[model samples]
Target chain A: MSTVLEMLSTPLFQRALLAALVVGISAPVVGTFLVQRRLSLLGDGIGHVALTGVALGWLVGAATGAARADAYAIPGAVLASIAGAVVIEAVRARGRTSGDLALALLFYGGIAGGVVLIGLAGGTNANLMSYLFGSLATVSSADLVATLVMSGVILAVGVGLRSALFAVSQDEEFARSTGLPVTVLNIAVAVVAALTVTVSMRVVGLLLVSALMIVPVAASQLVARSFRQTMTIAMVIGGLACVGGLLVTFTVDLAPGALIVVIAIAIYAGTAALRPLWHRAARPASTSEEARADATDDPATHRAR
Target chain B: MQLADPGSDPDPLHLHGVSVAVAGTTLLEDVSLRVHPGEAVALLGANGSGKSTLIRAALGQVPVVSGDAKLYDVSTRHHAARVAWPRIGYVPQRLSAASGVPATVLEVVLTGLLGRNRWWLRRADREQALAALEELGVADLAHRPFGILSGGQAQRVVIARALVRRPDLLILDEPLAGVDLLTQFSFAALLGRLHAEGRTIVVVLHELGPFAELLDRAVVLRAGRVIHDGDLPRDHAHPHGAHDHLHVEHALPSEPPTQRSLP
Candidate 1:
């Protein structure tokens, strides 16, 4: 505990910890919307797209060598994210039912493109592994700032457009009749989600990105009773996993991003295992007056627990 | 299904000389119908009767070739503030409340307010949302996550969400199509109450016996044209009243909404 406190005082440790916390909190919050929309795999879809963005970013900067990587990182990522989002949107517009297929195609295709680009640049899979799983120890203060700013914007969008977003998700035609500007808003949401995925890629790596984006949220929804409460709980769980991952990574010598995701999945498994007990214990006796309240309020017992 | 005789009269939403051809087949031909504001209407026909096609064209949610549905006082040529959108609140047949929709019952209802006001939902928004929920008898479900609600609850929430803005026109496509008898009756009661408030409701009615008492007027679509528009049987039980209004030449086929049945 003292060493953990000691680590917190260090600049490098503080930066990694903050980055993890920020990413952790933001992913699950956004994940709730994605999960509700049945687009949990879409995060994986965008994660692969971000890989292509990174390759493209690397390719563009490599003309002058690797020295310029930091300078071109965000712009390249942003441009690629926009392109990837447009492709997904086009497929959806064309009435493609399997968003997962589209995502898989995009993911594998982008990865191939990335691998080819790396080969052309004389880079190897070993060099790219850092981008795959992430390097939390290498997080600079600027990365922390970027994560904080992006997370703040994403969270703000979640709060302000909460109802409008929900209206679209629930009954899109009704939302249209209510004048929701569904097309524009839908596009904007995709772009924002793409952006969030792009930023998150740096923390969890392109491969494990969806776990961060989805699992924490899925776990929290299992526990939370309300929509708002679910989002809050997801954030808490995500933040905890990130902090715990960072602490573990520092203590033992494991990859920080992978450990973070590992911790998140463990949390999910833990919650699932404990749900039967919590669910049963939470149930009120049928003969009691409290049973009526338990029927609605205690949702754990509401489903087939 | 009704067909336009292709002569004499063209209803307000008339499809005069209009033949929509897609993939080398004609979908609708010379369809015409008049629908006025504050008129409780019905579009009745069997499946594939082009009822949905007509509704889409009338609302201008889709483009009609060689024909137009003109809202009174608005030119059909220019884009105007999402015309026919704010004027009508529509509820489609299916709504996905699948896992992960981040809205509550009250939040969904609040969306109805987005059209008339730009400000965030203040106290008045909450009050109106509550009132709409109360009108539907599901005010207690206001905070429930929308996706978690039962089918009956979802139906009532959709109705409440539609009525939140006090819309001039309400359009429901197959509102009672799949619901059970009990829920259907409750939905029928909601329609009656809305009609009492002087709001126009357009419901696509396939099963007429259940809703005959509450229907103010109906515009039957056969193929894509109005086959009947005039007094329908206001009371199914009696059917033999002196002033039944069913005999009128221009009386639409819907029952008079204002009249009460034999007690």
Candidate 2:
């Protein structure tokens, strides 16, 4: 308890916890749409692409003799991630390149470009390790501010345009038929997902950022009865995982990002194991008519089993 | 604002020699169809005959290779000449309402009210969505996750989603493809009520089983060309067999020669 209190007293720990909380809450916001659209790995692709941007930022800063070259990394990551997201969406939309091939291109191109740029900038691969694995100790005040602002924007769009985004993600053809700006809304989802990757990169790092986005949502779906519930519960689970993981790191010698993702996975496993019991407990509340309807009319349920 | 009189209104759906080709193969060839106000038209054909593609082309979902398609005199080809989508409700083919994320039946129905230039749904929107569900007899399932419902229930919810907007023209594709006979009858009766209320409907069907009595006109397509266009083709086998058979074979001959193309 004293150790936790002491950890909280330090400004570094405070900034890290704040960033984690912001990333935790916002990653799942954009993630709900991505998971719905079946583009759950899009954040990972954007993360790889952002690495190039981070390296480019470092190169430019070092060339200009800036006092802190790493400060420019976030802006660079944001631009590169957005660019990567748009390009990926365009490629997928055109249908010329297969979806997996496009993602492969993004994953390879992004990491390669980052490595090459970092070498050109006269920095060893070691300098990139912190960004890859995440170093909460190095999180600065400016990083926290950027994380907060970007997360705020993401939460607004994710929640405010829930209906439109939900329609588009659930059925693109029907959404387009309704004369919703399908293309614009699709791009908006991709852009928001990209922003989420960059926002979370400082806390969970690039490689594992998608875990923060996807695992919490997956955990929530095991018991959530509706999309609204899935989103709300996922946010709660994500925030808890982040805070819990950070606190554990203060007591144990472990990587915060890895610990956070492990906790989320544990929650998912727990949910899966308990889902049948949960369903059984809720089953008796239904009337006899609903029970008979399920037995005879609901082929989908039987097929699922 | 235009008057509410139906007689003076433009055709709800109009296609002028619209041809759509995906890849090297043509899906719809020079298809011209006009659905007048309050008319229930059905597009009928065998699989790969392009009934779905024709409707998709008319709605400007697929880019037309030549000619034009319009909704209420506004061209679908141009983005600036936007169609008043609020006046048209569309239900796609038997796509599973289930996605990676779970959605309540009410939430799915509420999406029908979206894209009408509104960012936020009002409390009234929830009531309106519930009313649509209630009309479809699936009001009890409004709070249930859409992914878990039976096919028939899901179909009703989807129809409710389409009807929530009170669209003048309802376009449904293969609404009864995979449902039980009882559900099909109920669907037919529901559509009959909507038709009696004077809504224009354009539906795509594999066979006009229960909907035969509801549809006023049938446009038959074969190999991407309109082979027959006029009154519903009489089923010689079951001339008076309305709602008697659970399944009805296509009235037209199955294997019409490929050379017989309409000019």
Candidate 3:
């Protein structure tokens, strides 16, 4: 308890905690739509693609002899992931390349590109390891600011266009018929997903970012009765796991990103185990009410008029 | 029922020599269909006969290779023409309303009222969605996950989503495919009421069961071509059969061969 209180007063811990919380809130916002579209691994693909962007920034900085080449990493990642997302969405929409094939191309090509580019920039693999596995203690104030702004934008788009996105993700044909601009919305989802991958890369690292995006939502879905409820509960779970994981790291020697993901998975496993019991407890009242309603009004007779 | 002259009011849906080809294979060849307001028409054919493709082309979902599809005289191919999308309600073929994520019946129904410019939904939207569920006799199930519902229940919820907007034109693809007999009868009655209220309806059906009395015309397709486009064919196999007998024989000998040719 003393250590946690002391760590809270330190600037480094505060920055890391703030970044984690922002990522916690934003990752699942776009993740909900991705899950609905059955593109759960899209974040993982985008994360791999963002690695190439990070390497490109490093290479460009080395080429120009900039004092701090690492400063350009986040911007490069934002651009590259967005580009990768658009290309993937186009390929999927055109039906030229199969969906899984496109994702595989992204996953393999992105990591290879990053490794090759980092080598060209004269950077050791050790420097890239921090991004691959996440180094939360190294999160600078500028990185924190970028995380806040990007997450703010993601939340605005994710929540503001919830219904339209839901419509398109749920039923593309029906959404298109309603003139919801299905193509534009599809592209938006991909772009937002890309942004989420990059924003979370610094906190949870590129490899484990998808875990944060997906596990919390999966955990919440076990008990949630509606889409809105699921999103809300998932966001709460994500936030808790992130803050809790970061706090735990203060007391122990552990990687915050891995710890956060482990905690999230634990929550999901616990929820899955408890689900049958939860349903068993809640089912009787609702079923009996449904039975009583069924007795009073026959569905056929009510619909006949 | 009075049949309005085609030259007077613009049709709800008009396809002019529309030909759709997907991946080098033609699905609809010079298929021209006009659905007038208040007319209930059925697009009937056996499996893989282009009945679904033709309607998809009319709705601008499938790109037409050589012709035009218009909604209220505005070409659907031209986005600048401003198609009145809000006035048209479409229920696609038997796709599960359930998605990868669980959505409530009300959430799915509320999506019907969403448009490109509309982002947030109001409290009134929820009420409207619930009212649609109420009309479908599934108001009590509005909060239930749509994925867990039975096929018939899910079908009713989907139909309710389509009807929530009170569209002037309703296009449904294979609405009764997996539905139970009881739900089908009730659906037919509901469609009859909607038709009586003067809304145009285009339904794709494999067989005309309870909807036989409701449909004004039947356009039958065979091998991506319109083989019959006139009155609903009488079931010659069962002259004294029940009114609800399934009529699956769409290729009637009475249809003129001249109507079968592509322009």
DockQ: which candidate is best? 2
Which candidate number has the best TM-score?
Answer: 2
Could you give candidate 3's per-residue lDDT for residues B1-263 as a string of tens digits?
A: 34344357689999899899988999989888889888999998877899899888888888789989998778887662288888889998967545768888899999999876665688899999999899988898888777766556777888888988888889999898767566778889999998987889999987787888899999988889889899887872222244234433322222222332223
Which pairs in model 1 have colliding backbones?
Answer: A36-B99, A36-B100, A36-B101, B1-B222, B2-B222, B229-B252, B230-B251, B230-B252, B230-B253, B231-B251
The residue-by-residue lDDT of candidate 1 on B1-263, one tens digit each, is: 12223243222243344445444555666676665544567776656666676655555554567665654334232342446555566776666545663456787788777652342456779899999998887888787667666555677778787878776567787776545455677788878877666566777766454577787666555665556666553453223344335323213312221221212
Considering the two chains of model 3, state its CAPRI-style docking category. acceptable
Ranking by DockQ: 2, 3, 1
All predictions: root-mean-square deviation over Cα?
8.2, 6.3, 7.4
Of 1 and 2, the candidate ahead on DockQ is 2
Worst 10 residues of 1 chain B by lDDT: B253-262
Q: Measured with DockQ on alpha carbons, how good is candidate 3?
A: 0.34
Please provide, for model 1 over A126-182, each residue's C-alpha lDDT reduced to its tens digit, 9 standing for 90 to 100: 656777778778877777777788878877776567666655655555666666666
Clashing residue pairs in candidate 3 (N, C-alpha, C atoms within 3 angstroms): none
**lDDT of model 1 at position A204:** 82
Worst 10 residues of 3 chain B by lDDT: B253-262
- For model 2, residues A159-209, the per-residue Cα lDDT tens digits are 988888888888888877787888898899889999999988877889999
Quote each prediction's TM-score: 0.83, 0.92, 0.91
Q: What share of the true interface contacts does each candidate keep?
A: 0.37, 0.61, 0.60
Quality of model 1 by C-alpha lDDT:
0.67
